[model samples]
Target: MGKLVTVGEAGEAVVLERLLAALAVPASVSGVEAPLLGPGDDAAVVVAPDARVVATTDLLVEGRDFRTDWSSGADVGAKAVAQNLADVAAMGAVPTGLLLTVGAPSDTPLAWLEDLGRGVAAACSVWSTSVIGGDLSGASELLVSITALGDLQGRAPVCRSGARPGDVLALAGSVGRSAAGLALLLAGGPELAEEVAPELLAAHRRPVPPVGAGPAAAAAGATAMLDVSDGLGVDGARLAAASRVHLDVDADWEDQHVLDLLVAARRLGGDDDPWGYGLVRSWVRGGGEDHALLATFPAGVAARGLPEPFVRIGEVLPVRSGWPAVTVNGDDEVVGGWDVYA
Candidate 1:
């Protein structure tokens, strides 16, 4: 199990001060410019270089979004930052600052908060971003909420609906990894899968999204794009609906993704059953949370070739006459995803 010290030991009064230290960034090391001003006022002041802010926020609560047994405070911290900043990146913008607010029970460990802050600081460091300010409070369960601000630097924000019929659908990173990892954890967990798939645990605990690829696609002339936080079938359909086009995904069981899923099934000690393939298919098509970047490039940009980290996965087609907007191998494939209420 992960190590931690209780908040009771730190005392509620001094918690903020200590946590702030953990959240502080090393601008020199990270290459992220220091904020105009950090914590210590009614509000923090941050610059919007493009004079426009691309803002997005997300909420993660215990039990619903994560389980304490599965992840540590640091993992949740890094994860919270990732999900929000990834939205900023998908807009083809660079994150400049973040506003974080967390609520936790009194029994919650002080180390958890410190680790959470450190996690946020660490992930932000990669994108040259920093957390300027946030709030702390008492609650029955741990709750993490963050709002990320980004700079467009004079480029048009890539929307989810700009894809055209002739555009090429592409993916910057593989999806279903988190799903595969989650499956392994359910089948046996870290102890059982120690030798078989340790990487699966890492994938589930901390997801490193292709934040840089969004900008690269923007530079390469991406027409539409989004982070595959929801499974591809669900998210891809969203993109298709918004762009008024149809998305046909490539489906070849011999594909690398399928092979990877097969590996996970073997770890579960499952025999070669059709049900195993079905589970893998479900994960590949619907298990979102890997934070892969999906985009559509116009034929013009397609001719010159797409950007690095993005490989052609499908093609934009005319919208369905009256049904699903996303398909596989030119036919209908059931769409699934991690909808909060679904």
Candidate 2:
């Protein structure tokens, strides 16, 4: 049997060496060339095509951002990378590089750390990019921070402020599954078996955002876009505030987004929602962590004309003085969203 080792036993140099080895992937297989310079360098260099770079970063702290009991090291690693990369794509850019920084206590296991490295490599392998550089630190708990860089390819970067009245409010990817999964975990209903709702549990542990949708939306002339990490209610409001417009989310129950959740709700006995309203609708409105893309397209664009994976969930409206910036319908009731402060 192999002996289990901890970070305290290996020291920083050996630990870093092993982790770097685990992260190494061949360009031939990954279709992603190694960075100009990678780990062990003081700083890594990445080509900024079109002379413009799009960068985004996210900080994940134990307990606050993720729970160790709910996620493995690989799950945490992949989720951190996915969230940051989704942000870069939201700006209408292709991810080109990643930088990972990890802080862990000495008692952490070497195998767990290697799994984290492998997870990062697997996530980055899906694209033509690699982790360029990173730092290690000793801390009381595990912390993961990732910064992802992207290339615009001469295309203008999309921002949240570009949506105007008459634009179509569309969504790419999904909603509520992550929150639903978390709800299931907390509720632990009699029917919460793996066979019943494996997808929901998987959604919470490892969210796979549609990475290409961001750039595709930009190519399709998306006026504004953002990553849906903080639920539609919160992120939609941010977009509305930035664009000084109103968003009316008319989530057709027949829409695919709601339909998919309907199956899940039925699987979990409908009334299992810890949130409110219809279980599926509540999750659809407030679920975050799916890392989906929410974008605005110009008026006159047919819902069918939008690119793959995008569905018209709502429309842009003129800003009202005191009205809520976002409404599920004409009225602003039965709202749901994620709030760190709340």
Candidate 3:
């Protein structure tokens, strides 16, 4: 470990000082109302033209949530933004602005910071959202926090608890690939990794959230919807509880090719419990960071823009008086997900 240094509290520009300098000011945009002493002030006041405000935040820390060696600064920035933005989308809202905070050591490369900024800018541009403001500070490890604001356009906000019995469980993106990529990274199987595609690793490192599916699902008569952040199994359980319905995931129901790829990745990694690592089982139940769209629709309603292989993994059962267990292949199983407090 490196020696710890504490510059006197008297040092003019302490850790927090340089960080603010790096962040500078928010990007220029119109209709944002007057700054009215933003950021560095005691507090900030801004007008919300819409009576409703959609808000979500995510935090990324070095080594725990990400690694510098595995992901570039840009990747980190993009991932951070994507996760929070996805949350807004889950509520069936459109992201309008982001407030980001970054913490890094003084010796961190300037290029890295520039790349991080570029990453944030690129992601914001993709969704047509702007970085309204943020904070910067020095820390022992790199940490990125982003809060996204969204607008619902007077539509009802879709939540997890609205599903009724007989609703159809639907998904909008591929699962297990991110977990598979992580497995390949751990095994260091360059040959097999190539087949998985280095970009797939980006899915784990910097996930491409399904930005369009949220509103589409809502418009398509989705009774309930959520972004699949935690593994499918665990998040599904959450929906089941909120909606007071039992969710049964037919792992056997997924496409053969997708299952085969997951099995192959597991073999390459030599993991005895392939399902536990967020691919077969956990991803089926416990995977996280996918940001895929999972929604429950009223029977007979057609979902729009649902791409190929967007399978109906499960269905909502009536609110029964029993433990909310996810049944897989005829056996009830525990929901696979990380213990945040752990």
Give the candidate order by descending lDDT: 1, 2, 3
Alpha-carbon RMSD, candidate 3:
5.2
Q: Candidate 1's residue-wise lDDT over 37-119, tens digit each?
A: 87878898899989898999999999888888888878888988888877988999988899999898988978778888899
Tens-digit lDDT string for candidate 3 (235-300):
777888888787766655554425644654555534665543344544445557868878888777
Q: Using TM-score as the measure, which candidate wins?
A: 1
Please provide, for model 2 over 1-342, each residue's C-alpha lDDT reduced to its tens digit, 9 standing for 90 to 100.
146488888889978887888778888888986678777768998888689989888989898888777777888988898899899989999998999999989999988889899888888887556888898889999999999999998899999999989999988888888887877766664247255577878888889998899999998899999999988888888899999999998845324566555555665554565433477766877788999999999866644599878888888999988888888766754356655666
lDDT of 3 at 167: 75
What CA RMSD would you report for each candidate?
2.6, 2.7, 5.2
Question: Counting only residues 3 or more apart in sequence or on different chains, how many pairs clash (N, Cα, C under 3 Å) in candidate 1?
Answer: 0
On a 0 to 100 scale, what is the lDDT of residue 263 in model 2?
Answer: 53
Error of 3 at 169 (Å): 0.4
Once fitted onto the true fold, the runs of candidate 1 whose alpha carbons sit more than 4 angstroms away are 1-5, 269-275
How many collisions per candidate?
Answer: 0, 0, 8
